[model samples]
Target: MTAPEDDAAGALAGTPEEQRAALERWRLVLGEPGQSVLAGGQLSEAGAGRDAALDWLYGRDEDLERRGVRQPRHGGDGPSVVTTVDWLDDITTLFPKETIERLQRDAVERYEIHDVVTDPAVLARIEPNPTLLKAVLRTKHLMNPDVLLLARRIVEAVVRQLVEKLATEVRHAFSGARSRTASRFKVARNFDIRRTLRANLGRYRPEERKVYVETAYFVSRTRRHLDQWQVILLVDQSGSMTGSVIHSAVTAACLWGLPGVKTHLVAFDTAVVDLTADVDDPVELLMKVQLGGGTDIAKAVAYGAGLIEQPRRTILVLISDLYEGGSEHRLVRLVRDIAEQGTKVLCLAALDEDADPAFDRDMGRRLADAGAAVGAMTPGQLAAFVAEQVGR
Candidate 1:
């Protein structure tokens, strides 16, 4: 019988043709494993480099010990750090950019390799992609003082990217809303002659030679009071909600600077942290969020409800998966009460790029029954929704 690895590779190494075919498939998934299997007991220069890269990623220590291939020891007490840097450097050549990023993300998430982000040597060898940057953001509390600056730079870069992608669209929507409001006919003092002519053009009679103002347009001088607008973002910071949390943080930061907008952000898990003061800086706000914890939707909603001085002027957005750890009845009640107070309430399963989210659909339906509009939405859709509510 063949070894389990060979069985996994789907070839028993009976002939040269079978061996080569299996070897190629194994190399794609297994990275590097046994020397006898990969090299066929005859290693060449190109094969040796491939073996080294594969070994760093997928080689088993037991197989190395069996082969009697003694691993070299680096100088100092930082062997893991040195080994990590070497692994990163090797994988760059061994994998495509997408695969490399996936591997980096896997390593960080599975192993909790915070050292890779902080160690200058590892940082030097690899590019800081969004996955790694998000990991760094998630683990901000675990970061050392020495790496704080580098971490800040990474967070800033990622935040700026998100802001650049989202700011213009959201701002334009808000501005468009304002323009519509500003153009509303409050007094109807002056007729818009051009618009009047365009409207009545199809109904013109050559014999009569006269166009009637059937629906005359008027220029209004009404100005929207921006100061009356209140936006409260209640974000769930549970581990599964990382993507939503990142988006909510950056969004809050963007909305905070809007003229006449009073934006308040609350990040909650089992514990709630009012991040409104830090909303001006998304990096700082994100760093303050503790990602893994039990969720309390009622507590968060109740807190947000207290912040609403005028419910009619407020837009309350609850960003969560609706997996309540607290009293579900209370959560539903609070959502109903808030909406009844005239506040426009939105219950989002998530506010990320992935519109089809895995969440508690039953709970979302419950909230919907209680008067809140519950659904999964991309950030762009959420932005438009916000503009529509605020402009109302």
Candidate 2:
């Protein structure tokens, strides 16, 4: 009847049950540190399980040290502490599917907890997503034969999703544009209803309230006749470039064996490795990638250059952060030479879903001056660019 008390814990403006629920939500949000501030320090059975699950992941944050809050250690001298398996079980039981995924992702990516994917129990229980897939690629080497088998499921699932999505973009880009000239082939997809109606408008019958159609116009597909134009993707396999590396592999797979284009995938760190042989199987190619090392953009570029048969018919895409470790001068000179020789050079700083790139601006500028287009692009955008270039 009367207004309930409200404080830092939360507003207790409803029934007693609702009031307790509000307090528990606040407790989970504020974490272990807020227990002192809450009116009732005790948590319900479900509430305590949820709290332990949340703490298992977020409590590992080093920033808690600055706040003077010591995180509770699990599996110590305590009898009922949460281990990785226990945390997984607790979160999956107490939280929804989405929350469980976030927790699993945080454990693998944020906390560097390889056990999430390495342990058979945890790997089987976890959901397959892009973040988890990246983690699997990074740590699959650490996994034994049995664990690697489980991790492959994550790779295949994530790669299948990527291929399905990117395949549409590639199909649309290469589908060809409609031309004004009438096509001899009367395909339903290329039917131009607007042009057909306008072309036969003079034959409209007012009494029937319909136009007497004479000839149906079909839109002609206009595409350039390409002579085996090569698309060489030089990807940097540095730790920071993992996203780009993953996307590049998938993109190459999608672009593989297209009528007018030949796809080449090359991954590099300090050394260059031509992955074109395995480009068709992105999952295998990604598994073989070693994600951390010094970057040598020049060495990779030189290797890509050697693969070029006809300079005018090649498109060299260098996917990297542009932090050249080999020779900066040599890198710039190679790019300049390649661009001047009629090769379409595209220096992409990043090639993932998020086009936001972290690259060396000075180096990017020099590459631009060397006649290479320098910028970040999503996989879809890159597909469109390739379509346009090949069409030209």
Candidate 3:
């Protein structure tokens, strides 16, 4: 057989169904690991699903060292990739001061940036690794399978900045409410329930029948309560806003941990699910979030508005593609009503990492009508927004 026929025969050697499985296995194992690898060499039938299959491969990884396999020149089973700050040397030049500072706060703790900063030997080796960036950007492929994953690492970086800043802000918020819990739980040494009950009973005759319920007989409240924060984050979780889910969820985790905040987080594509109750690991929380839902701004906003237990102290944030599947006017009307109640309402059309301003005009208009101030934001900018909203 000719080369093509030989290849075809090899592919079809097994039953037609098994052949298809073999073809998939070949693509998974023999797939192009990087653009540099694919474009530089090897032209074969196996290359047909290279990009799509590799996208799936990276999704299986739980961390960076795994997704883009690397080995340390120092000789260990560990990947070779450089993760130290000395390796990061001037990566800060790529971001704003605030972004850099935020990243440094988180990176410095788990990794030794302080040590790397002083080590000239380590710093000398620091250089831009396109391969690392490529892996970061291309992670979006796991969802939609349509989004170009290029430069996505930028988004992830910004998302981390937002989370770090929000963590600081929330810590401050919790601090500001400091000592209140201790004061609230302090024992009232002057407990005279019987005396108080007798005093109440005396005011009404036996026939008047003033029923005095004793507090000692009352059911105790559970300790499940946390300090109350009335916060609402309106995220446009559409296909266009794909990567922003990580940002919003991380922000949610910080806010969720606040000592006294009743926090509610809702991410929307076409529809929205109230993810307030689940903010444990941002990764796991997001894995539960699937894309491709149609945007229903009105429904989502209304649903969020309903989540506010205290209108006066509540903060409502709306993030979206603005390509809403409902009436903008009605949505804005709802926003206006929520705002009128003293709820702090904010709306953003697109939350991209180094993204442009894109939004649904009618829905934007409705958001404005609702008295919501809308804008385009990145995860870094979102930190300032969160800080301002929480007044931390």
Candidate 2 structure lDDT: 0.88
> Candidate 3, residue 19: CA error in Å?
52
Of the two candidates 2 and 3, the one with more favorable lDDT, higher being better, is: 2
Estimate, for each residue in 154-234, the C-alpha lDDT of model 3 and write its tens digit.
334444565676677555533431221212232443234454575566465577677554342211112223435576887
The lDDT values for all models are 0.76, 0.88, 0.55
After superposition, which runs of candidate 1 have C-alpha atoms over 4 Å from their true positions?
Answer: 1-26, 30-55, 58-82, 118-120, 178-227
User: By how many angstroms RMSD does model 1 differ from the true structure?
Assistant: 9.8
Among the numbered candidates, top TM-score falls to: 2
Model 2, span 1-392: residue lDDT tens? 32222464354578878777887787788887677434655888999889877877888798886678884444656566567887877887899888777877788778999898889998888778888998988887798999999999999999999999999999998988566788889999899999899999999999999998899989788874467889999999998888999999999999998879999999999988999999999999999999998988999999999999999999999999999888999999999999999999999999999999999999999999999999999999999888877876
Off by over 4 Å in 2: 1-23, 36-38, 41-44, 71-77, 178-225
lDDT of 1 by residue, 1-392 (tens): 88755664564546866766566545544443444455554444554555565555444345556675555434676535427887787778866799788778867776566767867667656676778777876776766776766777777788889888889877766664423222445344445667778988988888999876567665543233355678899999888888888889878877776766789999998878899999988887876778887999899999999999888888899999999999999999999999998998998888887776778999989999999988888877877777766655
The candidate that wins on lDDT is: 2
RMSD of 2: 6.7
Pairs clashing in candidate 1?
none
- Residue 234, candidate 3: Cα error in Å is 2.7
